[model samples]
Target: MTVRRPAAALASLAVTALALTACGTDQQAAPGEDKIKVVASTSVWASVVQAVGGDGVEVEPIIKDPSADPHSYESSPQDAAKVTDADLVVLNGGGYDEFMTQILGSSGQGKPTVEAVEDEHEGEPAAHEEHGEPAGHDHAVNEHVWYDLPVVQQVADQVATELGELRPAEAAQFNQSADRFEQEVSGLQGRVGEIAAANQGKQVIVTEPVAHYLVEAAKLQDITPPSFVNAIEAETDPSAAAVAEVQNVVNARQIVAVIYNPQTESPVTRNVRAAAEQNRIPVVEMTETLPTDKTYVQWMDAQITALQSALSQNR
Candidate 1:
């Protein structure tokens, strides 16, 4: 169910991405015809678009460094250039890429954009700030919606719908990709359910809450204090109280597993990892960008495996 892309294929995708970073792919346009130029706000969004659009569509990725925290990214002139020519844009809305909205809107292209937010789309509130502001709600919506299979399905659906509208002749291909993509998401949901159900309610701690939705899907209860969560979300190191509470939680063996954002890790996360180790708990380190070789489900299955291992160690 979880097919791993061959390294060769990934290498090819990477090269293709690099070569076409600033231009549309030739495969996108027919002889003497124009192609649909699109700008995806993040690499994750771009990947999802590529998954659905395949070679029929051309996407100019705004964020080249997939490892950088999208929450704090600034738009470059080049980024604006891409949006200006794009017919459509895909955004991880939930405060994930607010900077993009302005850039794309002002492009004179009047490009239509799809915002994949949590409410009725993903689940919970976005866990972090977008462009540095709270998502205007309290539930920590998983801005990393691409990691959440259910919401990811919604995102793919929205994308396919828009793509279909843009090029009706290619609607069948778009619909096919959407169907396959949705099936993959459903399969991932089942796989994650299998793993999470095995250790439901086990407590876990997150450094940045980047993949909290997947963690919750794995049935792991986050023992990371809301204060600490807020601190990391706000991009400010935790206050003394939050740090102390988090340290205590780590030291107290309050959680069985610890997961961290390797890309934007802080000393506080390192401390949490140390505490987990001191307590002999296992830790899972991950990135905001999903692995290139993995489908969302496979990547999540790997995380659950880490969780299962961590929970076993805790016991």
Candidate 2:
């Protein structure tokens, strides 16, 4: 279930952020807090920042809940205050966390802001209004860049670059950390590619597009109906016709597995999962945010392993 925060709450947060910005700007770094302060929009991005920043930076993520939908997140006063005082703000800025952007803008802080989506996928295909699907979905641009391993590497590089520019004294350390992170991410890509090669052209259905990039990275075919995906993403019940179409695909066992998100729950999505199970199709759960116990790389590795196991059963 998704909770909708009141507009007044957000307005209050904006006000708090602005006030904090004014107070924080003129003050010197505190005695024990000399490290560079970095704020991220989500835990997934925060983990990357911690990896690249190592001991030289303090990273804070505003949206830390595993179950909250990042797309519809509301900022709290504490989140506003964090962004206001940050030296650098990192966000998945393909229209994903506009609340973060709004807070940063309203704070009037001159901190450096790095947007992962725009920075990582330079010269890539232009995003459709909702880029991650079978076809036309009138939602915002897809901002789930963290699922794409290649893009994650680029975002890490961008983070290192921005941090180096912010504190050039620690430039070498940042670059070194980034190199180590890149190697780990590359390993993940290799594993995913291997799975993709083994399951070439395999068809799958998703409750939503949370893992669309990952599915595509594995070179699997997404046979989900666009209407079904769009409806789930828009937080509405899929129309009767749209629901039936997806049920037909699953009932026929035309796909190898069904990918569902345990974090973002909806009645419609639950129904889809039940149908997939009834048809004896495997169900793989993917998360949009990092789990509290797992690091970014570990989270991706587990999901990839689960997907590989599911696809392997099709043989």
Candidate 3:
């Protein structure tokens, strides 16, 4: 999605970034700066970097608000300044946060950058394919890759490698931290597997495809109509027929649960939720960013548990 930023705002940010550059505040650790400065596009990735960097890094996320829509996020001068001053930058590429690209492009800095979905943009196959998922899984069409646990693990390892390159003395520590984090992620994956074993082939629906990877991992079928999904993702209203079809499915309780994204709620999505509630079908919220005071793992664990509970209740 193309994120529209005011040209005047971008120009002002560019000028401010240039001024900061002229002040010799390069992308390097200054005297008495003990931690590496890492900037991420969202708090989800920021939390991952923090886990891997442990006490050796200071991570800042531009879009930390859980309610904010990352697809349409606007960039500010302060955000540009953060990217310019960051020793390393991490972003979920694949057009999810184009604002980060705009800021980085204008900075003209050659600092190292890590893109979680870099493989997708580089013409490489999707991460799901690499992990032996079914060939039919359209991971490339779903940019919300953070829902993919294996991809998250890979991003953690990449973060460790990038941090190690900056501080060789702590390279081993970073790798070890990443390993520990991956172990925890594995535990979460195990829970997902249990859900799959119990609820395989069960039908579910989503207002948006934000949790596509997670649903796929659970072996649950997403019966959301394609036209409805396309319209919602494109920020348009679904046709009356499409909306009625989804509502009918919910009213019939054909799906076990409705995976709703409250962060991107619209009248249509809310209507779907209402129909699900009226039918006593479970509605589980899946957000794009971390909730307040929750770590990435904690947030994901809660979501998985919620999904399992919803499915179990249906059973």
Candidate 4:
């Protein structure tokens, strides 16, 4: 599949690599440089590569916390330096990490970039619209496809393919990692299904669209507050009317829990959690970005359990 790059992608990287020729006379390499150096756009993507890479790779992630939004990222010269040096780069593709692309675009990061969301599953069904693009070159679709399992499976397959080729010596390890990742995806699909079918059609609310795919997978009905979703896109506080609308949704609907995106914090969440408590509804704190120590499957399983508890509350 063709990985979309800005018009200047190849030109920038080509120029930079040429400039490097003027800076240093000796060809010095990074210490322990035998491993494949891959750049993952997010912490979640980084963790998956780490899982699949094991000893064969050294994966560096650009955004590492639950508190930062990739939508409004500030890329520095240092970030460009990292991308320029990468052997392979992975991005969420539906335009989620524009900063990543921008850094690479300018720094001359000609290293092969795998579009995690769009490259792998161009035709398969996905849990969300972020899955694939039209057969042509349009890139205006939803970009947060990593929230779905099929999209993630596609991501793993693409990542492994790149790793296998870049580090042919680690081919076996990369293949094994891909196989294990695929199995984990299947297992996650089953577990998510079990949780969703158990509380099928149960009402839920979210601070962001992070868990939209899983909510779809688990069959939880989302009564997402328009204010929260909108405010998030604008990076501002919600209006009083929006807040009132959210409170009304929680109180009127038997909303089992509010799946708050840890990455996207809001005073709205705090107030809504209190409101949910007053209404005797539960709150389930969720993360779109993975923790430093979690495997992808563990993170996903915990989320399923959290959703189940929220949905089954006071039922």
| Best by the lDDT measure | 3
lDDT of 1 by residue, 1-315 (tens): 000011222122222332223222222433225666778887777777877888777876687564677788888887888777777687777677767866754762334455666232333333222323222224445466666677677667667766665666676888899899788778778867876767788877788777766776777777777778767877888789879888888888777777888777788777887888888878887676666576445666686666666666655
- Cα lDDT tens digits, model 4, 1-315, are 224232223323232342222211222234346777888888888877887878778898888876678887887777788888887788785457878767766775445676654432343323234434322112334455666788778667666766655555565677788889889889889888888667788777777766777777788777765556757655788787777878898888557788777667767777887788888777787776777777777888787777776666656
lDDT of each: 0.66, 0.76, 0.81, 0.68
Candidate 4 yields a Cα-based lDDT of 0.68
Judging by TM-score against the true structure, name the best candidate. 3
User: Ten-residue segment with the worst summed lDDT in candidate 2?
Assistant: 1-10
- TM-score: model 4 vs. ground truth: 0.81
Candidate 2 residue-wise lDDT, 245-312, digit = tens: 88889989999999998766788888889998998899999988998999899999999999999988
Among residues 3 or more apart in sequence or in different chains, the pairs in candidate 2 whose N, CA or C atoms overlap within 3 Å are none
Q: After superposing candidate 4, which stretches have Cα over 4 Å from the reference?
A: 1-33, 118-141, 225-227
**Model 3 C-alpha lDDT per residue in residues 274-309, reported as the tens digit of each score:** 999989999999999999799999999999999999
Question: How many residue pairs collide in each prediction?
Answer: 5, 0, 0, 4
lDDT value, residue 66 of candidate 1: 47
Write the number of the candidate with greater TM-score, choosing between 1 and 4: 4
How far off is model 2, as Cα RMSD? 7.9
